[model samples]
Target: MISSCFVTAIQVLILFTLSSPCVRASTFTGSMFEVQISTKLPVKDWVKEAKKDSDPFSLWDPTCFKFVSAIKSVDNQLKEALYTCHSVPGGDENTRLKIYLFIPPERLAPEKQEPCLRAAYKKAFDDWKAGVSANFQIRPEQVQFSCELSV
Candidate 1:
């Protein structure tokens, strides 16, 4: 009888804790970084190709095109990069393209923070270069990439 009562009390306490409004879930701020892709081609040329058809993400791989398009529509800078692409030089003849990406804090798990972020960043970068190479029919190695992280 004592053991039963103890279990019942514990259950009630658990229920009360679970239902408490004062206890809030933890929130995390994800990491944000910019990727710069420098191309010999003009930025205007890239934008023109992107705007050609009903699907503006034609320059991106079909697999990630929709994802990229959704990211593009998230803010006023929607026209930037589909995934936050911006002409860093802000000129017609400039060859610099900057892309912003966020890595959810959950992805930073596995104990090693910096390396995890770098790996994730690299993967996203590889995809971008692949898309760029495909759009221009050039080799992936020819794509110039650099990472920019704001302090």
Candidate 2:
């Protein structure tokens, strides 16, 4: 139990460190909308093909916001994901799930970024588990992912 707790602490620290920039960046902010793919693709093929396509994510996307980063969750049978495709809005050009965030600059709250991010992360894991219970298989570029602010 102690070991598990220690590992959890370490994981939290690492996540906090990596996510701090996204939560603190001044130029952009938005939630990382994750979507799960129903089919499994070879790892290399999946990564190579994800950013090259432009199918829009209509169901999972919250149209009220725009994001700055986009990412895809990796597939592993032992683990499930919460959301697939991490994306950053208002940044450069990255082939995305088609849904965009439209948040206003004036309403930005760099410090309060954790709640949304944490919520997104939690949802991603939940989605992963739900997939299995629902008989949904994982797919390439369709795994869980998150988007943080670009530094």
Candidate 3:
């Protein structure tokens, strides 16, 4: 009973509603970054200085603490996102290493961080949001630093 012109007009209105500014999408990007630097001291002084979730001087010579020479853009100035694990098989594993979570500032304080996070680093995706719920599957080798969806 509806004419073709009326149907076309209704379709146009529906299309406009879906394409309005109120429905704009969020813009953000995330990536898993690994900071790798070697210690030259015979006893690994740099590692001793580096603290978990604590960013320490990249190179140390006793007086002035410095950031990494090559690091340019880091959102986490305090570098408080690093976690250290000694479960690796090496006996001296605890002596010479550090780990850090590099989350971009644009991706920080999101209503939903994970939904906006890189698919590869889903462990941080769900938790970044305030009340979001989801599951995460972390590999056993990376369990110490990852989130498990079930628990």
Compute each candidate's TM-score over C-alphas: 0.40, 0.24, 0.19
lDDT by residue for model 3 over 48-127, one digit each (tens)? 55443143332222111222221122232323442221111225322122222334433432343454343423433222
Question: For model 1, what is the error of residue 67's alpha carbon versus the real structure, in angstroms, after optimal superposition?
Answer: 12
- Best lDDT among the predictions, by candidate number: 1
Ranking by lDDT: 1, 2, 3
For each candidate in the order shown, give its overall lDDT on alpha carbons: 0.41, 0.30, 0.25
Over the stretch 49-126, how does candidate 1's per-residue lDDT look in tens digits? 556756534554232343354343333332342323334443443245444333433343334346655465456556
Q: After superposition, how far is residue 72 of candidate 2 from its true place, in Å?
A: 20
User: For model 2, where is the 10-residue window of minimal lDDT?
Assistant: 1-10
Model 3 TM-score is 0.19
Measured on C-alpha atoms, candidate 1 has an lDDT of 0.41
Q: State the weakest 10-residue window (summed lDDT) of model 3.
A: 1-10
Instruction: Please state the error at residue 53 of candidate 2 in Å.
Output: 23
Comparison by TM-score, 2 against 3, better one: 2
- Per-residue error for 49 in candidate 1, Å, reads 5.7
Q: In candidate 2, what are the lDDT values of residues 1-151, reduced to their tens digit?
A: 0111111101111122232455432222322233323343233444444445453332223221112121223243213222222322433323233222333222233443456654563454454445432432333334433333322
